[model samples]
Target: MERDKLVYKLKEFQALEAYQVDLFQSQIKSLEDPHIKHAFERFTVREQEHEVFIKDQLYSFNGGTGIVGPAFKFAGMVTGKALDLLSLKDRLKLGIAVEQKAVQMYHEFIEMTRHDPQLKELNKYLSYFMIDEELHQFWFKEHLARIENIEAQPH
Candidate 1:
């Protein structure tokens, strides 16, 4: 793809991701557990920071006025509300899946963009997010396993 087209695509992606920022904050409200609430709070902050960085990257194009991204069909905030209703086991399962999805998205971006010299810096930025997502997934999964083990007990 041409440089302009690639840049445009990235801008759109950034915008879509930016739209998801509020969902993270909403999630923190849904979590009752102090540790989980705190974790989501951190995720919320990072997401907001990520939005700013993406906006800055798009600043030169369209005067930083265009967050023209593809539409996200599902209501993510509604998902957070639903998560609040689920049991801890269910929430952990879904949270881990969410992190895994983020990791997958970064890998896909890296795979598609790494070959382009222009995208090298974006790939580097995405790699950092991927690592964080992986770590979050690990943290959640470990807790989930402990919960499962306790439930599996003969008590």
Candidate 2:
């Protein structure tokens, strides 16, 4: 891929990671469960790391950090607030959907990078990010199932 094109793609991913960080951080503040809040805190940190990694990759190509737009950030915040009003199971379901989309995005990017010799490192990073997203998805699924199971139990 051309340097400019690769940089543009990286910027897009960086913006996404930034949005996720904001969303998770906002949700963490409203979570009453200590375990859930802690998980979100960790997710926020991981997403921040992903953003920084993408920013550094952009810098390597002499591309400036493409700052996420204010409107996008605002949307994430609003979404997080709306999600907080949902039941825990509903929140987890949404989280699973979000993480699944992220995983798919990373997987597609990784496949695109497969034929480009210059993108090997980026491909590796994308794989790592994808795995993290998968883990997040799994966590949400597991918790959602647990919630459903408990609700189904005889009182």
Show model 1 residue runs off by greater than 4 Å.
1-8, 15-20, 65-69, 73-80
Worst 10 residues of 2 by lDDT: 68-77
Tens digits of per-residue lDDT, candidate 2, 89-149, equal 7778877877887888789889889889888898999999999999989999998888899
Which structure among the candidates has the greatest TM-score?
Answer: 2
Reference-based TM-score, model 2 = 0.87
Residue-level lDDT tens digits of model 1 in 1-155 = 46455556567556545644655566676667898788778876776766676666567544755445453343343454565577777767866776676677668877877887766787788788778778878988998999999999999
Alpha-carbon deviation at 91 in model 1, angstroms: 1.7
List clashing residue pairs in candidate 1: none
List the candidate 2 regions with Cα displacement exceeding 4 Å. Answer: 65-80
- True-structure Cα RMSD, model 1: 2.9
| Candidate 2, lDDT over the whole model | 0.79
RMSD of each: 2.9, 3.0
